[model samples]
Target: MTSTEQAVETFDSLDPTTDEVVGTYPVHGPDAVAAAVGRARGAAEWWASLGFAGRAERLRRWKGVIVRRMAELCDVVSAETGKPKGDAQLEVVLAVEHIEWAARNARKVLGPKRRPSGLLLANQAATVEYQPLGVVGVIGPWNYPVFTPLGSVAYALAAGNAVVFKPSEYTPGVGAWLVRAFEEVVPERPVLQLVTGFGATGAALVRSDVDKIAFTGSAATGKKIMAAAAERLTPVVIEAGGKDPLLVDADADLDAAVDAAVWGAFSNAGQTCVGVERVYVHTAVYDEFVAKLTERARQVRPGEHYGPMTMRSQLDVVRRHIADALARGGRALVGGADAVGERYVRPTVLVDVPEDSAAVREETFGPTITVTRVSDMDEAVEKANDSTYGLGSTVFSRRRGMELARRLRTGMTAINAPLSFAGVAALPFGGVGESGFGRIHGPEGLREFARPKAITRQRYRMPLVMTTFARTPKTDELVRRLVTVLHGRR
Candidate 1:
C-alpha cells in the first residue's frame, strides 16, 4: 500500500450496487501519509510567506480549476461513491463556492487587528493575529465527499496552511481529483496531498505530527482520533455523526415541510452527518404531515435519485436500527425491514417509535427517519434538543420559525428550510455535545486552522508601572482606587 516511486500504483473503488470496481486510486499508507505531510510542511511555509493577497490569488486560481473541471471531477466522484452525477456536481459546486468565500474573506477573518485592552490596560496597545498552524490533516467521510471535507480544506488553505487530506476509502478517487486539481493551479509544492486507505490509514494521519486535525465520521472513530491526537497534544476539529431533527410546527407549510423532510432525510441514501434523522411534527398537523411525507418518500426511488450506501458495513447498522424500531411497536409508513437492500436502502419512514430506540437515539446514517408527534411547538423544540448530538437542525413554521429555531440547542438551525444554514457561507458550522467541537466554514473555519497570537507593545512608559519591583505602596493604593472607580458601579 505504500508508495514505491513518485508514480503510485492503483487500488479499486467499488460500486456498492454492483459490487464492482468503478474506479482505481492509489492506496496510500502511513509512510505515504507521512511523506505527504512532510511535503505539506514545506508548502505551508511557502504559502504562508506569501501574504494574504498572494495566497488569495493562488486560491482563486484553484477555485477556477475546480470550476472549470467540475464535470470531470463529478464523474470521478460519482463512479467512486456510486452517487448520481448531479448530486456529485452539486457537492463540488458548493465546495467551490466555499473555497472562493474562504479565499476572499481570509484576510478579514484572520489578519492582525487592533483590540482594546480594556480600561485597565489602556496604556498598552493590543493586537491579535491568527497564525497558520503549519499543516492540517483532514480525515473526511464518504458522504458529501467534496462539500464536507472542503469545509475544512478550503478554510485551511485560505488561512495559509497546507492540507494533507485522507478521504474515505470509498471515495479515494474523488479525493485524488481534488488534490490533482489544486496542484494544477498551485503546483509550486504539494499544498494539498491525498492519502487514501481504511481506518488504519486514518488513525495514522491523526497520530502524525500535523499541527491540527479535522475529522468527519462516526463518533466512535472520533473518540479514537481524539485519543491519538491527545498523545501529541494536537488540537482537532471533529464534525462527527448527528441525529439531527426537523421540526414541523402547526403553522408550517405542510407541502414545503414534507418536501424538506424527504429530501433532507433520504437524500444521499441518508448518509449525511447533519441529515434529518428525526422529525417532530406538531400534533395539530401530524396526520397531514405524515401523509405528505410518506407520499413524498415513496416518490424518491433509490439508485435513480440517490446512490447505494458507499460503505457496505453500514447496511447492517441501518437494518438493526429499523429492526429495533419495528420491535418497539413502530410502524413503517413507507418501507420496512425489506427496505434494507443488498446495496441501497429504500426510503423508510417510521412512526410511533419509542424515543429511546436506536433509530431515534443513535445516528442511523441511512435513508430512514422517525416521525414523532409532539403536542406543540414547545414539545417539538424539547424533543429536537434532547439528542446528544447537536450538529444541525431544521424548523418549519410561518410565525414562530426564527424564534423556535433559536430555541433548539443545535449549532446551526434552518428556518423554513432544511440544512440551509450550511449554504449561507457566512454562518459557522459545527456541533456541540458528542457531535464534536470546533467549527468549519465561515469565519470560525478560518480561525480553527489558525492559532491566535496576541501582541502588546508599550506605547509609552506609564507613570504608575505595575510589572516591576519598582511599584510603591502608594502606587498600589492608587491602582486600587482606579479599579474601584471603574468597577464600583457594576
Candidate 2:
C-alpha cells in the first residue's frame, strides 16, 4: 500500500449495548483532514455554481434516496448508538424533513433582495445577497446522530457550501453511511466528505481551511473547538450541552404535562441536549403532577422504551448525579442510585433535590429528571432561568403557556408541547449563554453557512454631493441640514 494509504489508521465503532464492533472506519488525522478540506474547497465552487435551482434538484433527489432507505439507516443508527429502532427512525424522519425543508427554502432565505437606501443615498440602489462560504466543517454529536448533524449539514449544503463532516467517535458508521448516500446523488464531486476519528481528528478539521465550523457537542468540547478555529479566525456555530427545564403551571393539563415530561426526560436515554432535566410544578398541582409523572415513568423500561447509554463513560456521570442528589437529602420518587446499571440507566425521577445538587445543576445526559415544587409560575420561571444553559425548554399551561414560555430564558420553547420547535424548520434552533451561539435550523441556519455580500450602484447623482472631492462648504451645509431633518428630532 502507498504511504498515503498507510498513514491513516483504523478504529472500531462498537455497538454500545453489546460492545461488539459494528463497523470500522479510518482514523483520519490532521493530514487527512487537511486533504479532505482541500478537496472540499474545490468542490464548493462547483456546488455554488450550480445555483439554487440546480442544487435544489440535487437535494431533492438525495432526500428521495434517504427516504427510500430510511429503515436501513435507522438500523445502522440503532446498532451503533444503542437506541431503540423506533427512536432511531424518528430521528431519521426528522432529519429527512429538515433536508427537504432546506432544499425547498434555501432560495427564498439566502437569495439576493433589494434594500432601501437612506434619503442621503437615494441615488444608489443597494442589494444584499447571502453567498456560499466555501467549505464548512461540521463536528457532530453521537446522540441523535443523523438528525442533529443534518441540521447543519443539509442547511450548509443547501446554502451552496460543501461540507466535510467529522462525526463523533461513537457514531462514525452513521456518518460514513450518510456521506456515502450523498455521494450517490452528487457523484461528480466531493461535495460531501466524511472524516471520522476521535477528538484530535475533530480539532484538525477545526484548524483546517474550512470557511466555518458548525459544532454540536458538549460545551467543553465546543470551547476547545472554538479555540482551535480561532487560530485561523474561522467562524463557528456551537450547539453545545443544555440542562433544559420544563415548567407546569397550576392551570396546566395534568395528563398532557405528565406525558410530555416523561417523554422529554427519557427519550434517547435523556442524551438529548434539549431533553428536560428539571421540572418545576405549581404547588397547587405538585402532588398530583408528581404522582402522574412517576406512574408514567414507571412504565418506561431500559432496553425497551429506550436503550443503553450510548457512551459507557457517561454511566459514571449519571451515577454521580443520582448519588449526589440522594446524598444531598433529595428523595427519589421513582428510581434511585440503583437505576444506573452497568450498561443502562433506568428512568430516574428525583424530588426535592437541592438547587445546587449536581442532578439539578449539571447536564446529566442520562435518563434522569428532578422535580421541584414552586409557589407560582414566577418562581417556576425564575428557577428555570437559573442555569448557565439556555437551549430548549418546555412550558405546560392552559392559560399561561405562552406567557411562561416567553419568561423562561431559553433559545427555543415549546408551549403546551415538548420538542415541537425542532420539528418546525422555519424556526431557528440554538441557545444563549453556555448553550453556545448561532442557529442551526430555519432561515438563520441557511445563513449560518453563508456570508453576506452587499452591493450598491449609483442610480443617479445628486446635485449636493457629499462623497466627492468636488463638494464645497455649501454641499456640506446642505448635507448637515438633510441629516438634521431626518434624525435630529428622533
- Cα-based lDDT at residue 129, candidate 2: 97
Residue 104, model 2: Cα distance from true site in angstroms? 0.9
lDDT, model 1, position 237: 92
lDDT score for candidate 2 against the true structure: 0.93
Backbone clashes in candidate 1 total 0
Candidate 2, residues 367-418: lDDT per residue as tens digits?
9999999999999999999999999999998888878888889999999988
Best by TM-score: 2
Give the C-alpha miss distance for residue 68 in model 1, angstroms: 1.1
> How do the residues 55-82 of candidate 1 rate in per-residue lDDT, one tens digit apiece?
8998899889888888888888888788
lDDT values for all models: 0.90, 0.93
* Residue 328, candidate 2: C-alpha displacement in angstroms: 0.6
Please tell me which predicted candidate would have the highest lDDT against the true structure. 2
